[model samples]
Target: MTTFRKIAALAVAAVMTISMGACGNTGSSAADTQDLVVARSLETTDMLPQTGFSNGDIWAIQQVYQTLTRNKTDGSGVEPGLATSWKQSKDGLSWTFNLRRGVKFHNGRTMTAKDVKFSLDFARTARDDKPWQFLFTAIRNVEIVDDYTVRLDLNEPWAPLPSDLSMSASSIMPADFGGKTETEFRNNPVGTGPYKLGEWKKGDYIKFVRNPDYWETGKPKLNSVTFKYVSDANTRSQMVQSGQAQIDEFPTAVSVSSLKKTRNVHVESFPSTSLIWVNLNNRRKPLNDVHVRRAMAYAIDKEAIVRAIYYGQAEKANSMLSKNLMGYSKDVKDLEYDMAKAKEELAKSSAPKHFSLTVQVQSGDPEKSMLAQILQESWKELGIDVQLQTLDSTTVYSNRTAGDFDVAMFEMTNDISDPDEWMQYMFSSSANVNSGYRNEKVDALIKRAAADSNQANRLKDYAEVQQIIADEAPEIPLVYKPGLFAVRDQVKDFTVTTLGEYKLADTTIARE
Candidate 1:
């Protein structure tokens, strides 16, 4: 069997064992009642903060580790996390953070400024090709000012530095935990978060127990949390419906509707910064033609996808940036879904008709599959033979990075509150090797916005950038789906942020 298949088999077996145990149990202990059981769509392969690239990895890391700052539950602002207070230099080149005293790691080690320095340095110099590595490139040096204070000297003024520091990739670890390999770190992670690693059964479930000495007193009300990996959407929904699981992440749209009506099941949806779209390979033929790319944009019925597939749980995306974000432009309108306009645009291209193209999508996501079918049907009407190919996430990402596919359906969420986080990596000529499309003007605007500390100027630059991208159509913006979480009605205070990060420390399980 393939490695993934084997892992899935083992996961199913482990879940069966747990389900049987739960079924056989009598209501005797408070520990059993207080534990929050959640169903996740994927298995977490790594625990190292900087190395994680998937939602599963982030979900695991956020619970075990702590960043200097974190976005508020509403994602409206930032709040103190490990660092109680911080200050930035007038020029914005230097930032100093005052660490929280008496903070203890999972291993009972005291967290200090030195640990913060070590973690930042490690993330900055990581050899792996982590997506967040570029965010740390501006850091000139990390100085341990004292036991409770550390300062970062930046190469240039970066307005989003504080928000960037709040990313999961910037999670602080113990000073002595630096030299361990990725496997070693994943096996035993040490962090200052409210939950500590309890037990990990690979491809099955990861159990986490509350940290008694958590920095925040009287917090983390739940005694334990068990994240069960169940990739199938229907199975995950069934687990929650049968009371086998208390929470389920990324529940299918169909499941969501039914779960909302089910008694004792509470469904919560947050406006996510997540953008779902088709990343066209601009280096390939037809796609490379701006007219053809525009044609594809005009052909897509984004509102229809949002309504039919997402069940009105999502909003049609007009530009690369989501409306919830800072730099999103209401001024730049989406290309209307007009078949006549699409045909006209295509006629202007070198290869006007009889062009065949393969669109790639990840296999498991029902929403993406539906989108692929919709696109196939729409493009087919335009005399284009569109082939839908489904592959695993790893292969799809690899293919995207290598520019091996004609068009790939992908979703990306902004880790920070700034426009630079999304724009630079996705659009900048020097950075976007994935799309392999470069426009000098777009690159210049991104750079200008990145450096300009003035909010108004940065907004103006980003608006222009969005206008250009909308016109050029490197990516066909489809929809922004809300981050959906279904939890038991008894599970209180559990919230998912716009960035899709969960805050579980304040959650509590009410006794029946």
Candidate 2:
């Protein structure tokens, strides 16, 4: 940083420090309300859960809708939600779920087998903007066994189905949607969860009210839950400290320490299936060669970045799979940060030492920006000129999908709580073909693991696949960022799942 830029940053920090004292707190009027507010960096215009994987959308929809299966609040595993019990066939082609009786939607309609089949059918057939359709693509048919039972017939044996059903995409809704059209239903959606949609101010905030006729007995402790949208991570942490929001969703990893030091604020972190990485386009020059990719990986320091950028909130990752993930292996050996190793690998590459390359990052991601700067300085030792280009999410994703850059920054999060749903995008030859990465061995292992019904065999396949991916080095892993949050001191019993789910059913606010 230049002297002038350093001075400007110090000035801004000074102003923020002074303002923190003047901000509100848990004792302030904002915290005195009966409702609990969660501050997030994004907003969801799409209220439907099956459409896209938005963190804010999942947090909101989970409060209003219940899926056939649900993640245990204590992070144990999948458990009964609307479905009282479920079992798969010995041949692994069919999955049968028994629904809970006397369950009611927000509109006072009782749930039945028809609702279960209808909801699954709605998710299976994608109409528009349904990125999670891949989760249900295996299902060829949905059959209503009885008024209280439903069965799903799959074209292939998809081992991820059971865990995938725990995602927000598999949420059960009223069969007729409470007599509302698509637009009308979106505006006033009804569900069988503990909360009801109250008001949604686009790009601003979404509010949910406690359901009076909820199936869960004596739950949803808060009178209302409001999700306030603030696009900056630093600002979200500040909001929690100021009591503007009782819970701050995924506060900046670098800012976790300072927020925890505050008297009225508490910082919480949990193991998560989130991996931040840089995909090296295997088809692009200077990055296409395995030696070049290996050299780049060795040259980049993940430990320094994770410590300085993520503070202590995350850990340096050796591979694409997070340690918290089910199929993660401790034996996969990837290139660690070593200047000597980098020089050794580069000597065998086409670029060898001197080459100017560009990496694309999404604008407004503070971590990515810091990471780019770190890369610019570190790779200079290897005679590499690193060029950074910041663009909007739409442009960044489009470029990534088109394989238009030498290197690109992105994060992979598991919404389904299963490794197959997230790992395939990184290593599977047929999946994410734009990455220009392919290996028959890795592809076969991924296929075997994804189709096998036996957990031990699946784990063995994934373990081998992870090693192959690390050795190939198509993508470089940076950090395994956990599900992090900042909350006011008064908020208690908030559980953070491996999938980063906001399990609010068990949360409680201190009355005192």
Query: TM-score of the candidate numbered 1?
Result: 0.89
RMSD of each: 6.2, 3.7
Count: clashes, candidate 1: 0
Misplaced by over 4 Å in model 2 are 1-22, 26-32, 74-76, 126-128, 176-188, 281-288, 343-365, 391-408, 429-436
- Candidate 2 structure quality by residue, lDDT tens digits, 1-512: 34224333543563365246436565354334558888876665667877644565776788888888888644446888888998989888999989899999888889999988888888888654565666787899999999999999999898888778888889998886667886788777788888899889986889988888877788877788888887666677767777777887776665665776777777787777778888888887878788888888898778767656765667889878878778889888978989899989989999986999887876655667777777777777889998999876556665765678877877656666678766666666545533688788887787778788888999899888888778768888888887778878788787877777777776767742
Report the lDDT tens digits of candidate 1 across residue range 355-375: 999999886666676678778
Alpha-carbon shift of residue 195 in model 1 (angstroms): 1.3
Residue 277, candidate 1: how far off, in angstroms? 1.4
- State each model's CA lDDT, in order: 0.80, 0.77
| TM values, all candidates | 0.89, 0.87
Worst 10 residues of 2 by lDDT: 1-10
